[model samples]
Target: MIANFSQYGIKKLFLPITSVVLLVFGSCKDKAQEKPTEAMVEEVGTADGFESIFDGSTLNNWDGDPTYWRVENGSLIGEITPETLLDANTFIIWQGGEPSDFELKLEFRISENGNSGINYRSELLDTIPFALRGYQADIDGKHRYTGQNYEERKRTTLAYRGEKAEISTQENASEPESLRNNVQRNAWQSRKVLESLGHMDSLKTKINNDWNEAHLVVKGNTMQHFINGILMSEVIDNDSVNRNASGKLGMQVHVGPPMKVEYRNISLKQ
Candidate 1:
């Protein structure tokens, strides 16, 4: 009788353990099936409410004379034509007709020795005037001064490249105990020098060459600029550099006859 009872106990334990193993395997399979579906959904719904401003074939949303801008290979190419400068007495302007607070994203590729920029909150001028009056995001094919903020019309640099070692050393020498407690934290990766106020802040990683992405967000009394996924500048509206609540957007085709800049995938969201 004792041997039979012991055998029964062993059999009951084995059955429950085997069932638990099967249940776990089934759960893992279900999770594996779910992952791909989630990814597909994300891929399709990525561009929420943003609308494409450039059609890749023509300049539809923008209003400007044909002599200043053209469409080629799916890019809005703005050039400084001899005729345009001579006749217009200034740069050509592309008016989108409507303006509001919004975010703008565009990809740009610069020809060698190329210097160009995206102009936001700008106005057409009888004279070319200064490039820094409105809000211009700096572009240089060499990446030497790319992503620097040129407060257009204002003629001041809001930010520039930073030095990492100097910032780290200063912090460490001043507060040894703080460094010990925060040793695991990363050193300043990217530097942004605010020339107007003489302030510097760390930025996201710098982007160079190739096609660099610029994201500008303007909302109410504040503005922010991001490059290649790093916040490069933040400023409040004051008399020295206050942009109109709304203004025209323009692209610069700097003064070299051979220089060419291509812009595409421009979209805006409000």
Candidate 2:
């Protein structure tokens, strides 16, 4: 009887110890689960279907004036001093791939007087080294030119900010009823019409002197520009002769007073 009682007592002691061990292990497992998993972190990194192009340390697949462009503080910075001001605008061409249809996103900050743009569907001009000619998503320190669709070394200012334009040679640009209504040319001499997309006052408040997000969507002859989640401008390029099918990507350093521009989180999805 005593032997049986001692065996029962041993089992009772073992039961509590086992339960304690199980509880401790369960608590530890819960804590581990509370921490962020690798997959969760990866999801946050590439959540927007964007793949990073810049490695944030080196200029591997890019070509430009090294003196003006560099990777600093995890950003692609372009700085021009009064002494290093150029006679013409220059660009840093991305050699990764000439994406024809893709969504390009990045954050940019510029000092007052800075003039910069994101050039896509562009070509390097043989006339000038590191020069690009194509559609430019223009940005300026004055905030007057931000989000305008300007062509580099081509038909300039295809569509101004707060304009939804359908550019075609099929009909007279003067009468584009089939494409759009309430059309007004940005300039009397230009065929391109400036249709209002949104108010400039509303757009200006969204943009800040600090870092601002820029999202560009280009598909076929259609292009869109979004800043801070607001649709700034879009263009439907149907002018066959003037429309660019595919070309290189370039970042511009406009020739002007001393200024600086910094770009980071440069991503693209094709």
> How well is each residue in 225-256 modelled by candidate 1, as lDDT tens digits?
67777765554443322345766677775655
- Clash pairs, candidate 2, are none
Error of 2 at 125 (Å): 0.5
Instruction: Write one digit per residue (lDDT tens) for candidate 2, span 1-270.
Output: 234547568665556777768867997999998998899998897777878888888888889999789999899999899789898898988998888999999999999999999999998889898899889999999889899788776666777788888776644433434323323343212345557888876787889999999999999899999998888888888777667888899799999899999999898998
Score residue 198 of candidate 2 by CA lDDT. Answer: 83
Report the number of the highest-TM-score candidate: 2
lDDT of each: 0.58, 0.83
Every model's TM-score: 0.59, 0.78
Q: How far off is residue 152 in model 2, in Å?
A: 0.9
> What lDDT score is found at residue 265 in candidate 1?
88
